[model samples]
Target: MIYFVNILPQSNGDHVIHTENCAHLPNMRQRTILGYFKTSMEAIEVAKKNYAKCNGCRDCSEAIYNNYN
Candidate 1:
């Protein structure tokens, strides 16, 4: 029932991706994605997109939950 906001880089560091809501998720818990971005915006975009995709995925919530755990 929580969310986290994360900034991850794309493999080439060209964009930054965001995650749930950082306030909800902690450092010890987070899904692992390979990305390298030059700025945080790009990462946020990716995370947002993933979140949208995860909305329909039953396993996605669990994945995020596990990472946050």
Candidate 2:
């Protein structure tokens, strides 16, 4: 499967990384592409370096957790 992720800049100087299809994703015009990854864990790792996990994106968080564990 082709997986993708994105990074959304926050007003607070933080960024949120979410799965491409995450329901919590901000509108397309509001987000930046972080690039695609082979696995969700890869995307999560990259996201963790620059942004916090979005609390509203349970699917993203759960995917990362499940992939890592």
Candidate 3:
């Protein structure tokens, strides 16, 4: 399966990352594309390097937690 992540730039200059299917994702007009990966973990890894986790996305947060723990 393919995995994807989005990088959202905040007004304060911080960034947030969300899974492609994240329910909290911004509207299409406000969304930004980071890139796609072969695995969720891969996408998460890249996101971790540049952005903070989005607490609004439970699936994305759980995936990261499960993968690391």
C-alpha positional error of residue 41 in candidate 1 after TM-score superposition, expressed in Å = 0.2
lDDT of each: 0.35, 0.54, 0.52
Residue-by-residue lDDT tens digits, candidate 1, 1-69:
223343332343322223343333325344545255543434444566644322211232333332321
> Residue by residue across 1-69, what tens digits does model 2's lDDT show?
223334554565444556677777667776656577766666656656655543223566466543332
Q: Name the lDDT of candidate 3.
A: 0.52
How do the residues 1-69 of candidate 3 rate in per-residue lDDT, one tens digit apiece?
333344455555434445576766667665556577665566566666655543223455455543432
Give the C-alpha lDDT of model 1: 0.35
Task: Return the lDDT, model 2, position 55.
Answer: 23
TM-score of each prediction: 0.32, 0.48, 0.44
lDDT of 1 at 31: 50
- Candidate 2 — which pairs collide? none
Q: How would you order the candidates by TM-score, starting with the best?
A: 2, 3, 1
Q: Which candidate comes out best when scored by lDDT?
A: 2
Task: Report the Cα lDDT for residue 54, model 2.
Answer: 32
Better of 1 and 2 by lDDT: 2
